[model samples]
Target: MKSWRDSVRNVVPYTPGEQPKEDGVIKLNTNENPYPPSPKVLEAMKEITNLRKYPDPAVSDLTEALSSYYRIDSSEVFVGVGSDDVLAIAFLTFFNSDVPVFFPDITYSFYDVWADLFQIPFERKPLNEKFEICAQDYYGENGGVIFPNPNAPTGALLELETVRDILDHNREVLVIVDEAYIDFGGESALSLIHDYDNLLVVQTYSKSRSLAGLRIGYAMGNRELIKAMSDVKYSFNSYTMNEPSIVMGTAAIKDEEYFQDTRNKIIKTREWFQEELRELGFSFADSKANFVFAAHESIPARELFEAAKKEKIYVRYFDKPRINNYLRISIGTDEEMQALVRFFKSMMNK
Candidate 1:
């Protein structure tokens, strides 16, 4: 019998959170915004009557808007289906070297899956005891460095100065910043792009903009790096970010007022939620993202996850040993957080 492709053999792909197709589950497992996208997004999609015509292969309008938003040249921007698509393109672009790609041991787990799928070599680096990125650890080896700011699952942020130090010290390596959740509250490495040509910042409209379903993400860097990623996309699927998504994406990015208000609301709710969790004997990482990483000293995370499921609430937990005891709970609205807290109070670490 013919087997599946070599890459497909016994491969455990990344498991996205349980998005129940059923009618009633409060899903907070994914770090999605609680708000719907701006009405402009709806208006834009409604205006698009032509489904037969192919989307602009270049995604020039969205790119230009994003470039103008970031004050970077349009040539330095490349839009993709999601940051995952662009990150995958990056794996193809800069990870062709024999050396292992390096990233924090506990970052977006999909980074490892992306490497496995692409058959790229990779090495994991432990984060500092404070759960912060240490630039020195990334130096002297590897083909590239990639990690989220206000890193995933943990949500611990690294300062802008530390970022500059890392890029300044590691001149040879391609430094990729996966800023999928950056809009929550963190310094963007995009600001450092003019100084370091190797820095590539990948971001999504999925988080702060409330457009995860739209599947639009873009990368910012110098023109040459953007060109390399673009080449990878063209070789695979030229018209990657389709018309509907591009339209929604443009509307999403352009709606700065909604973006700011929603992010601020999440931050406010997160602060109150953190205090409530702390009172319940839960330890959590200090976060600047839309989620908090936490576990109660008295409870096993797996138990809480299942219990929450039974209660029709969803939060994220990993089976990986170090993080198994912890849960990555997304910051929902004030009422949602209160409900989660109330449930936790009732459970009492059983």
Candidate 2:
């Protein structure tokens, strides 16, 4: 039993949200777009008849598409399998020092996994009682820094000026602002990439573009950081993206109007859903992401999660310290969310 796994790889891996298989299940546990991907994306995927060849190692089409969309240089863009893959590559390429990287203790659950898997030293800075990252806590000397823009699970967004403060303070190390949920309403720190060489903004097609199945993500930063990540990517796996994903992701980005419509619809649904939750006696942060971090006044989060599951409605509940009472409910379609609200009401009435 004392093999390679026992000595160096002994750690708890990140647990993703449940992906229920039963039909008609209101799947809202994961922060995936409830809408189908753009019609253009599907059409583009259908055109890829040549599946035998390897995808472009450079990922040229997708990279150029991202650069064009963001109005940044092609040299500043780096694409990968997903934001998770991009962030992992960044961890491997940049966070190589004795000093510990810093991130919010309650943000994306995967941050710690990447740091630990890469054997990089890191510290989890606690969010305040409101589950907000205190920008001052990230001021002092550290290794690299990374955090979700709207901050995950909690869905509380840190403002741009405050992000600038962290960037200003940590000039010596890389600062990554994971904007996975920014399209939900939060301001991106991407514009600051022009002023700061140390800033790298990682984004994904999963949330905003309704292309999670395509599994494409990219980063924008100074040419140096992009080059470094690109080098690591090529050495590790040149074909990080498949032909279908590359073409489909580009098509998804190209249909900007549809993208905005879906994003806005989700935002509107979230606003309506928040008010409904408040009326049902649940308290939550002012979420700017596609999900709500909520806890009922009297009901335990575990009980609520189980009740939702029994009703064929799956929502995320993190049974962790300090956040055990809260559930992270992803915004589903209007009908799906209404069903969830009705289920909650029935439980409360009982």
Candidate 3:
């Protein structure tokens, strides 16, 4: 009998932070915005009552808005489900058996999982002692390069100059910057498209736009690079993205004022939360994102997370080595933060 199975055996799925269904726990495991999406987005989505017809295959309107925002040509953009899809496309279009891809060892864990799923060989280059991506070490002969700016968990930012240097020095290599978290604080590589044809910058409306549930993301690059990823997406699922998402995302971009206010609130909350954590004898990475990475000398990250859950507050804790000592707490509303702090203080006093 012929066996029917996939090459899925060796692949280990990426584990996102624990999300519990209990209503009492303050959900902060995923780095989702604590605020609601722009009112305009909700209005836009409501207009899509007819589900029988298909969405625009090209997603022309949303891409046009993104094109103007990033100041790139429309041909240089490809809209997809999320930044994760854009990254998965990058893996399919660029990574190959001929040469291995390279990324920071401590970067978004999903990158490694993507490589394994595609059977693409890859190597994890260790970040510098300061946890910055070492451009010098990345010049080795490889298939392509990919990493996140203001990387996940660590929340560290790589300056634009450093990113440009890496691109210039490795001209032949395809460089993909996952900018999912960059909008919160870091500079975007969307500005480098003119100089580097091989640079692919991925972005999501999930973060700054407070549209995590909308599942809208796009990529910017030279027309050819964008076209390559499109081919992969088109082959598998031509209309994978839905009509309501497009209507909502396009409207969200058009309403810049609401987006800014929401982003500003998140930034304010992040800064204030960082200060409060510091006062509680915690040390952590200098965050350049919507989340704060912190740890106190007295409490283990796992224990802190468990204790917070008991108080109906939940934050993220990765059991991975090195990072196991730290918790990645998403910046929530001021009241939510105060509640978390109050619980921590009471736990300590007890």
Candidate 4:
């Protein structure tokens, strides 16, 4: 008789940033927004009294709000728990072919995890020496493609021309442009969607809109692609979003003034932090995201990571190849960033 253990499928899981429990810790590891959600979002949450009933299976209200904001048809929008949920469904829906999906070797770590969990074949194309994606590398045939616009950990932005080139080369397969950090500085590929029917542009409220707690993310593409992903999503879970998220997310999108104010603040802080890091002998690519990935000229990243923890200052340090010496420091409020600079100055002086 065959043992049940033989049927088990195992894969390495994705590790998220550490969420420290200590109070007064200057948390900056996870790249979370350093601001609160819009006041309108708070008001909307207070109005969500009907929790006894299940949420709309279609998530129509939030979907319509997103479509209106982006000036797209409702049929072109697909909402999910977060960008991760949207991406996972995309991988499962479009990457069933035998050909391998292509993404950067240094992209979002979840790409590989999702591919593995879904048993989809994938290949990691190496980024150039500058840690920027080479569009020519993706010119070859593949099942699908996905990469973040400003990228993660590296914060390198790929311009729309190059994005168009990639889309131009692989017109037969679906291409996903993950714009989680686009609001920080980089241009979004949403405009290219009308030109490239195979394109799916995914964005999140977690970063710019300061709505990570709401777990709201959506994708814009042609109606066909949106319909396919929605079908897959409904098959798995009809009510993936709760009533609170739908109401709060709709409010968050409508408050354009507050959204712009918070994101602009983070962008300004990131620029200031980058300059401070440079002065402290840290070197890195000019980041377009809300975080700066830097490496000290003399000290090791692990050393700085530990020293910051001792001071109750938190930042992300990856123990991976090529980027082992680098630290991804999330942009916080002006005061928090000033505190981080002080910690670095004190540590370097020691």
Ranking of candidates on TM-score, top first = 4, 2, 1, 3
Query: Residue by residue across 1-350, what tens digits does model 3's lDDT show?
Result: 54656533766788876767777668777888889998988888778888899988989989998888777799999998888888888888888657888898878889889988888888999887666788887878888998899888788898999999888777887999999888788999888988999999888987788888889888899999988888888898899888888788888988888878888888888888888888888888789898988879888889998888777787887778667888888888888888888887887873
The CA lDDT of each predicted structure is: 0.87, 0.93, 0.85, 0.92
Q: Could you arrange the candidates by lDDT from highest to lowest?
A: 2, 4, 1, 3
Those runs of model 3 whose alpha carbons end farther than 4 Å from true positions after fitting are 5-9
Model 3 weakest 10-residue run by lDDT: 1-10
Runs off by more than 4 Å, candidate 4: none
| Cand. 3 Cα-lDDT | 0.85
Candidate 1 C-alpha lDDT tens digits along 1-350: 56567435555699998888876677889999888888889988987777799999999889989999998899999898888888989888888888998898989999999888877889988887666777888876788889899799898888889888888877887999888878778989988998999999999988888889989888899999999888888999878777898777887788888888888999999888889989999997788999999988888999999999999999998998578889999988888888899999999842
Position 154, candidate 3: lDDT = 81
lDDT of 2 by residue, 242-262 (tens): 998988988888998998999
lDDT for model 1:
0.87
Clash number for each model: 0, 0, 0, 0
What tens-digit string does per-residue lDDT give for candidate 4 at 1-350? 79998999998999999899989999899889989988898899899999999999889899999999999999999999999999999998999999999999988999999999999999999998888899999999899999999999799999999999999999999999999999999989999888999999999988888888889889999999999999999899899999999999988889999888898888888888888889999999999998998999999999999999999999999898988999999999999999999989988883
Candidate 4 lDDT trough over 10 residues, lowest sum? 341-350
- Model 1 stretches with alpha carbons more than 4 Å out: 1-10
Clashing pairs in 3: none
**Model 1 lDDT at residue 153:** 83
